[model samples]
Target chain A: MASNLPVPVAESGDIDLVLRQVLQDVLGLSSERVAELDAESGLFGHLPELDSMAVAGLLTEIEDRLDILIEDDEVDGEMLETFGGLITFLSDKRSDA
Target chain B: MPMAALAGNWPNPPHADEYAVSFDSGRAVRLLIVPALFDEANKLRHFTVEVMRALDRAGIDAMLPDLPGTNESCEELAGQSLPSWHAAMEAAARHFRATHLLTMRGGAICAPTGLPCLRYAPVSGVKLLRTLLRAQVVSDREAGRDTSREQLLENGREDGLALAGYSLSPEMVRQLEDAELAAQDLPDIAQSELGGPGLWLRAEPDHDAAQTVALARIVAERLA
Candidate 1:
């Protein structure tokens, strides 16, 4: 719901911060490791930790935390390309809701 | 940590013995453990086993049953639907004369209704399927074959499709899409407060032995 919709940002801020906490918990990463990551941080192709299997688990966690339903046709490289991209997509989803 | 007592069938409903087992007989057993499905099942098995052992030690009898077509059972998964699984759990409870249930993750949605069960880390089946369906989409897209939700659902319905390495029936997918582990399904079902993070979410499936012991103790105390 747009009720809690956060304002847009130039770089990963709120969504990234929230998502990073989820990443740390869901992926079993230390807070320091997730906190070290930023908007420009590359994922999927870059992070060996984010493999196909891991991605599925991550998506499930994201949905659980964010309460967003990611559609089949909605998935693509751009959305999962970087930390910023995922945050932006999530932000948009919240706004639309 | 208690030893895994044994893996054998108990007799009451003769057909149920073909699929389930409990360590104790008659009124000694009080709980039936329905584990999470697929890979989560593999990761959660060790944790579940330890909990069962602790429960046994705490004077609460817990039974773990293999769903038809999974683990040692040779039955095909093609026809195994959610209701069938529920029926199986019900039969096992009846066979063991169990008074309560303890379920983990996906099993939360499959537990027999009206029983006083404890659900730990119950995840919505619809949310889980969305994750798997997205994986299919991404995999297909990478393969140069883009697909839509309708297209994927149709294909899944027509032919049994595998998700997260486990082959699933189309009917199972449909039922799962509708299944929820919300309060409505289990009004009186109490939620177990388990410590530690969800192991199923880790990139490499890791086990937390201490967490398992703590969880087992909590479960044992709660049922006491």
Candidate 2:
């Protein structure tokens, strides 16, 4: 079985900045939009543009932009249910990559 | 499997960038080839080819165009929408006046207008999203976090949250949250509409035969 380890936050804040940048670009939200977001902020409620089509589109965008492969079987709405959850998921995926 | 290979060897008339291929039935068929999501597209090449060959053998002409951003399609995936993709399929149908359309799994929605659709293990997009949410909840539970599947389902009703790798929007979440495959009450096409020689092939052993029968009945009804 694979070990489930919590991701480590960057002390230098560089990774955080990059992660946020990726989020902004992928979500097509302004920095101001992301500013109010927390780790738990609901992405769907907070961002109206994220429709089912957008969700699929966003997944494709993230895979392309991050150069990470997300299997269809591996994705779920909860993993992206909040900003924090999404960021955490990305962090883990990036580390693994 | 042998039949598929044999069909692949059959000579197909050459056409321009987007043209129709005809069979003895006289129905011009348009091909709407959809790529699988992300890495699965590459991994499932053999299976897709097999399916294409099967369709060809069945006398259903199809074109498996690579989706934008996946194979050779032009549009960046980020810029594409579900409606636009559907529209593209519609365009293919109109262009060909196709008699039938074939799709696999998620691509089942690719049927051209007025033509009967043949889906091999069709998966509803909304259902796919919900299943992903359920899996996440299961993952959380496996990680030692005490979580309930019901709570996870309820969470969709709360505020929309973006899953880590998935970038679900609030509206997307709501749509997925509220989506019920049963409620969609998809018409029974197999029994109603597809009586005139249609195929509904399901994977053996593990797949649900009852559901397959029900779906085939629906397709028959709709296409009959």
Candidate 3:
């Protein structure tokens, strides 16, 4: 019932900003470090700070900020494999919402 | 510069030997800081202390108390529940003669009501529990254990659940599943207000000087 409630649609740029901020906030990466992360930049196993626990926090923070729900089933190594992959996944989710 | 010192023993009901970190200069504007719970607690410990230090510089006294089964308290985590934590916070408020409360994240749930409070990025109990459960699930997957969140919740309600190294009692888990922000309509400080991302979500313990100054100024101005 709560999920059925109307939610605001986030713009594409909003998703990009939210993702970048989540990475910086949850991973404690500096803004410069986050900016350096391009589409090909690896995440997950690449970043030492993005450990399992940090992954949980990161996902939760993203959901809270973007106002979109990320089900556990939707979470996989592919979506979190790179900066571009994550941005695409979130953008898709936002458009679908 | 104000120094960190231990407050006198608070006779917190069944627990009598609890300790708290206080920046006391006998100031009139006193604050009782209820920190984030569990893993977030570890991540935000330094940030919370820094906030307290900033408050000290603002000429206000604040105390960060050890809830039963947390921090320096000797109680077992498996035996503690939300009510127990709320009780401990109430006792701490009374013992410290606190005039206001500073609650962080999940700490907002157990904060003693009726006091003028400053809640920083208050989180729901369900979200907190989910974060812990997800962390456990991730860790288990890495170790090839393959546990689901639903399965973990079932087991948590039956017995105690071990989440991110914290053994939560069934009652605590059950209560947390239904928990939301308790102190409503109070002054809330969102992450944006601090002009940065939340430190509690950080991978490691970290602090920001801007956040410290912003939070201190907010509280000081509120009291002023």
Question: Number of the top candidate by lDDT?
Answer: 3
Model 2, which residues run further than 4 Å from truth? A1-97, B1-45, B57-60, B69-78, B95-97, B109-112, B136-224
**Arrange candidates by TM-score, highest first: which order?**
3, 1, 2
lDDT of 3: 0.85
| Candidate 1 clashes between residue pairs 3 or more apart in a chain or in different chains | none
Better of 2 and 3 by lDDT: 3
- Candidate 2 per-residue lDDT over residues B1-224, each given as its tens digit: 22322121111122113222222233344344443443234434454554445445544445555443345444444444454555666665554455555555556543344555555445556655544554454456446565543565566446444342444444545554443323122332232232221121111112223443443344333434
DockQ of 2: 0.02
Candidate 2 docking band: incorrect
Candidate 1 lDDT, B1-224, residue by residue in tens: 33457678644243334455455533454888888876678767777777777677777777888876687665677768888778887877776677888888888888887777878777777766766766666666767887765677677777867865667898888888899866743333222344567777767666777777777776766666
Show where candidate 1 strays beyond 4 Å. Answer: A1-12, A95-97, B1-4, B10-29, B182-192
Tell me the docking grade of candidate 3.
medium
Per-candidate TM equals 0.81, 0.39, 0.90
The second chain of candidate 3 has a TM-score of: 0.95
